[model samples]
Target: MTKNRWDNGITHHDGEAREFISTYFSQTGRRVLILASAGFDLRSTAVSRAIAQTGVTCRGIFIREERPNADQALRARADKNAEQLKIVVPDSKVVFIDIFDPVDQAVVGARRLTRDVLPILAEGEPPTDIVVDASALSIGISFPLVRLLDNLYGQKPGTPNVHLFVTEDPHQDDQVKPDHAERPMWVPGCDGDAGSDLKSKSIRLWIPQLVLYRTEALRRIHDFVDATETCPILPFPARDLRRGDVLLEHYRTLLIDTWEVDPRSYIFAAEREPLDLYRTLLRIDDARQKVYGQQGGSLMVLSPIGSKLLGLGALLAALDRDFPVAYLETVSYAAQLGAMKNLEPDDWPIVHLWLSGVPYA
Candidate 1:
């Protein structure tokens, strides 16, 4: 809202993303640090493969969740991805961070990152580029890391370039279902003041990213936040023209009946373009700022329960304004591995965005 630098950001898609990584990372004297998740999702290794194909060795940190109740097939797939990452980047030492508190399922991943990953970034030979594959990691895990990097390098010119990579497969995403979601709570560092301590005069705006089969989770968050205004974001100019319609119809009961969201309150942005969503959110916040600047200040709480690309957009916007992000972390998933086996690489579009660095400077 306040003169966002990434309003007109750089983004790449599909083969173009691969080409960018290959050409740019293959250059001489480039110290690249990649942080990705070791997950059962098919797109877990897409970015790593792209970087490895360029013959450019880089540091790797793969996040592993310690979920005892996880499906066997899913665990196998995550283990397989972790091994494949090692094989792909054979020259470098890949550190794995196990980020899960088995007892209470609290948000300890950020604490683990500070202990395990922060020292590496703060070393004398700091990385020149930090690439985060947001596809496999949950929003709770990825948002804090992104915020940390932004706070560390976003303001400093010629600092480490921060890049975001996400492999988007709408169909594949639809196939996987989240199960046993925890209560809605604020994400670690992005926790905005949605609690009881918030001032009574403050206007709260809730922006939720729409997706399929997340009604229950979203309902819980909506009740918790009790926002003054609701602006639900829908995917427009999507790969499928009917997606926006489908989502609106799917959520009609919740939006209209439950939340009483206005017809004119719908926000739409390109499906694969994070900057589109980023700019749209900033515009909304700009209006709030102008109207409520002299008041107690408006609070925008974001719920990104959709695509990883959209989640990245939400993270970028939150970093700029310190917007609160509320989410229900999944305790276990309910996915059928066989259902996703037939998916081809071409079906998923790999996206790469240059978030910050010398290029922008």
Candidate 2:
């Protein structure tokens, strides 16, 4: 396994992901903190643990959102997961936090940075490094976790380095049920007339993060903007046969029919490699700023990203500069009793990781 770290702002690495995990566990004086969304992806979790040569201290911080239906399912799975973790790695501390306080959500800024999040990590000895998996999470919990991790990195410089990872294996061959959407709305990134003539300037840039569930929202954008001015960005995960062909066809029709632009040309696409997605956002923002700085009257917009790490990257980019972000918020969610079809074990190996909050002295 090879490793590559980011140069510009916050340091991030991308390499053979499994290799990183193996190397991380093998080191001495390391403590592991696994944030359990539901349960550990048994396969990946075992592989990571097996590589640890030195005896490593490990613990789990399980998440239970304030929702009733979801929490019920999560509780059952988390209990089983905790049992399994204890068996695999003895005496591991397992904690369950009841998050998603409505009042907390209503709060304007970061509510739990010092209060809830820091306290959780501060428990036990400080970790040397942290490995976070954002795969099992839906949009809501993942958003807050991403925000929390970002805040952690922003805070003390000497804090332990974080390795954020997610598994995305959209099994193309499997018959999948469509995700239920309460309403599919595609709101603009910045405040201008919704259908304002996009051709006012020769250069307008739009980067819409693509996913199967957001088909309607993407269509809404295609209808709203000149397709030539848009750069549709899709996440190419390690294993993603993300079968959004219907949505892709719909987008292709609009781009060709309306703006006469090649889908290939109006696309700034790449595979998201761990934290590099964060770097990609920074780079995209830099390019957009360069465009506007050199030539006034050019508009640039960043659309909503589905992946937690990538979403955090976009958030960081906007925080520094007034980067516009288009959003489609979900009103409700459905929780399945069993593993969801396409998102099951065959699509993915159940994954969890040991994250260290403090580097060993």
**Which of the numbered candidates is closest to the native, going by highest TM-score?**
1
| TM-score of every prediction relative to native | 0.93, 0.62
Candidate 2 per-residue lDDT, tens place, 1-361, comes to 1111232332223334445556666677777666544442222233223323235676655443333234444456556655655565563444343333455433211233224555778777776666555555433345456546655663456776555555543332122222333332333222233234642553556667655555565665555444346666555543444533443665665556754655564333334433455556556546665666555444555665454445545544443344455444333343443444434223343232222233311
Q: For candidate 2, which ten residues in a row score worst on lDDT?
A: 1-10
Model 1 local distance difference test score: 0.81
Top lDDT model = 1
Candidate 2 total steric clashes: 11
Per-residue lDDT value at 335 in model 1: 83
